[model samples]
Target: MTSPFDFDRELAELGAAHLLRRRRQVAPLVPPMDLQPDQEHLRGTTYLIDGQERLSFGSNDYLGLSQHPAVIAAAQQAAARYGVGATASPLVCGHSPAHESLEHELAALVGLPRALYFYAGYAANVGIVPALVGKGDAIFSDALNHACLIDGARLSRADIYVLPHRDLAALEAQLQASEAPRKLVITDAVFSMDGTVADVPALLALCERHDAWLLIDDAHGFGVLGAQGEGTLAHFGIVGQGGVAPEWQGRLGRLVYMATLGKAAGVSGAFVAGEPAVIEWIMQKARTYMFATGAPPMVAEALRAAVQLILAEPWRRQHLQALQRQLREGLQAAGVPWDLWPSDTAIQPLVIGRNESALKVMAALDRQGVWVPAIRPPTVPKGSARLRISLSAAHTGEHVARLVEALRQAA
Candidate 1:
């Protein structure tokens, strides 16, 4: 039977390469909260369970609302009112008032004509792309776009031109030679691994000149950027540019934005805001939305509350920026080798040259009661493994200091 597929050889090679991942089970915490003396797991922002403490500097809960009282209360109320599951797809009997309300709120938040909800960020990207662009069309994608975007583009059956990361000139050259009537340019607002913001203004400028459609996945930027957290478009002054804010009924001119509620918003869903036609087409044709079961009513309620909190609280973003600056300054003072990551947001990484070195440093930090994960190859480029250090507003000055200390020791 083909020599039993040689599973042992592959496993051995993966172990040798330091690419094997394992899950650590943790016991639940008791009162007078503390991490387990020899900790085994994590809960929310902190990395502890019983009586020990582990400073956590690696989480995407930017606003620390994942366990917020309001969000929990809202979800509980929703579960009571609408039950536990959606039970069907949106086109069936699953679309509830909660989903509809969130859509309206998101559309208003992003200044768009309409918005559609998806169960996951990957599903949102996958559904939106192929539904809009197809056989005779082409999608110009960034080389560093997330795996979800890459999968979605691949599924589109359209020619994909992967321009070099942030290379606007290369993109222009590709567009200049394009002959497709429906050319869509897809990019991430902030790259996941590098924590770098896209050159959106320049990209939008090029889109205007080329007369192409622009789609921005703001999964990493939402609730952490802009005046009121309208994401990258607002952060770069492109949405309300030149004293012209595109109203609900504005023409399908250029920009289309998609954001996920799981990170900064501290919820469990994703949404896309764009021209009415584009969203409507996704509703009708996108297989994920049409065939898959909709998100639970409870999640929709939680996201609604999360959006309100994002608008109501501005200090969270401010605290995050301050924390980022503190960490950067501390690292500098200690003479640590690192990169700025081209972002002022929560996601950050310290490049470590070798995979084994990265794993060893992460293990050392974990032993010293610090929990930061090592991001290795496949997630990043070869020879570019790093410790992906994420910051959250829930962290205090002491937390940052402890992280600096842990990094020093690990190094």
Candidate 2:
């Protein structure tokens, strides 16, 4: 008889395929005693792994606000006052003033009337999708949407039509043919792995024509795009200072905008913002939110501070853009022999085309004190394995230059 599980065989298969994933134990940077009082408060961007300081190009701290003194102070004050845990689900007694204020701020920033917080982005998507559509309903999803959205669609038990990545024609064809009573179109604002942005205006127009609801998970775009970091909608001028334009207001009832805090926001948790009634419905229905304990109040407070920083510090976004240009130009000038994906965002992929080759390049970069992870199947498609170089405002020109030189040498 076969054993209950074939764990050993699975492990061997994964190892042979060069698909095994591992975690690196990293140490946070500490300020040197020799630094001045003001300088000492600045957060160091480098991380120590295996007793070596490596210039990390894998972080999601886009604006470098994770260690900002104001964010830290806000977190500290909240933790001291509210302790480290909510100790109950939000529906119970877990909802705190911090959570409430953060939700309001997030809703305002995204130009939505209301917002509901969740423990994380994964939970938010999983909860919201199922709450909105199920059984006889239909969910039109992008082929390359994040796993959270995919899982949510699966859990909803709806007829899921995964149109080819960014193929608006295919999506429209499906929308035109679907007979389901409720149709929902879900997509990521920024494709996380490839870093390509979705055309929100086009999607909204399609949704309107088909009488469908649009749910955008702007996890990577929030705090990294637009003049005020309002995300991809603002990047496309679909939303303005007065909020989503009056023309788009008719579809606002069905627009569900979700974003994660842990990435560009430099904090924890996630939120779903939409019309008041839709948000209220989700609050009453999303199982993940109803069952799980609320995120710590301190994290919510820190996120509030992060929002303020994202709004006030426009220079940070400008500097990040500069770094992006520097890296792209340097890579082109160096003539590195890899297929670089076209992306204007923080994520830049150097496609190596084979799993082993991507791994070899990553190892070579590691030897040169540059830390960029090798992205392989099933994170990306087969025959398109790559080195995902994630940039941040914390990185400098020198850091980017060093990375370019290392890539040249590695290539």
| Pairs in steric clash, model 2 | none
lDDT of 1 by residue, 1-411 (tens): 546689888888889998887775433232213435443223355645234566677667888777676888899999999999999999999999999999999888876778999999999899889988998898999988998889999999999999889899999999999999889999999988888899887887788888888888999898888877778877876553232254412434577789988999888879988778778877999888899999999999999998998889989899989999998888878776645455577888888868998898898888888888898878888898888998988777778888888888766
Report, for all candidates in order, the number of backbone clashes.
3, 0
The local lDDT score (0 to 100) that residue 317 gets in candidate 2 is: 91
Error of 1 at 230 (Å): 1.3
TM-score of each model, paired residue for residue: 0.92, 0.97
**Residue ranges of candidate 2 with Cα displaced over 4 Å:** 31-44
Error of 1 at 16 (Å): 1.6
- Quote the lDDT for 397 in model 1: 75
C-alpha lDDT (0 to 100) for residue 94 of candidate 1: 90
Q: What is the lDDT of residue 94 in candidate 2?
A: 96
Candidate 1 local distance difference test against the native:
0.82
For residues 93-181, could you state the per-residue lDDT of candidate 2 as single tens digits?
99999999999999889888899999999999999999999999999999889999999999999999988999999999999999999
TM-score quality measure for candidate 2: 0.97
